[model samples]
Target: SDQRTAWLPAFLAYYNARRPHSALGYQPPASRIPGNNLLQLNS
Candidate 1:
């Protein structure tokens, strides 16, 4: 429980901001959300 609480924020940020998903055309879910910010991935 302690570990989960400690790591949850970091994990959620990664999951929402960095981790790419196939269902999203191999892009991170965050990129799809309406926002001015952009993330660039180097191939």
Candidate 2:
């Protein structure tokens, strides 16, 4: 939905700076969003 998409950047910021991803070994989006690591996908 638009609600989730609209805040993508916001979530990305958090995902990169605050959220700890298990697949990312507790890393954030900054290191898990772009490049070859496409598993951490979003809409």
Candidate 3:
């Protein structure tokens, strides 16, 4: 359980920062954040 807890943050980071969502036009949730570099790179 400790190992799972340790990796959970990494997994959540990837999910919220990298995983694309169809509802978001295939962009990661992080891209919607103000001044996120990811939006500039994608554009």
Candidate 4:
């Protein structure tokens, strides 16, 4: 049960920061967020 607790944050991060959505022209929401470390994400 404890392991499942981690999924929400992971999923949100992926959904908002990694996985691109067609609505945003296939760009991740994070790209629109100013000052995020893009290099760290690439790694």
Model 3 lDDT, residue 15, Cα: 91
The candidate that achieves the highest lDDT relative to the unseen native structure: 3
Better of 1 and 3 by lDDT: 3
Stretches off by above 4 angstroms in model 2 are: 1-8, 32-43
Q: What is the C-alpha local distance difference test score of each model?
A: 0.85, 0.76, 0.88, 0.83
> Over the stretch 1-43, how does candidate 3's per-residue lDDT look in tens digits?
9999999999999999999999999999887877635466567
How would you encode candidate 1's per-residue C-alpha lDDT over 1-43 as one tens digit per residue?
9999999999999999899999999899988865754533422
**Judged by TM-score, which candidate is best?**
1
Clashing pairs in 3: none
lDDT of 1 at 4: 98
TM-score of 4: 0.63
How many backbone collisions does model 3 have?
0
Model 2 lDDT per residue over 1-43, tens place = 9999999998777867788888878887566457775665863
TM-score for each candidate, following the candidate numbering = 0.76, 0.38, 0.68, 0.63
Model 1 residue 38 CA deviation (Å) reads 14
Model 4, 5-38: lDDT tens per residue?
8688998889998998999999999877567566
Error of 3 at 29 (Å): 0.5
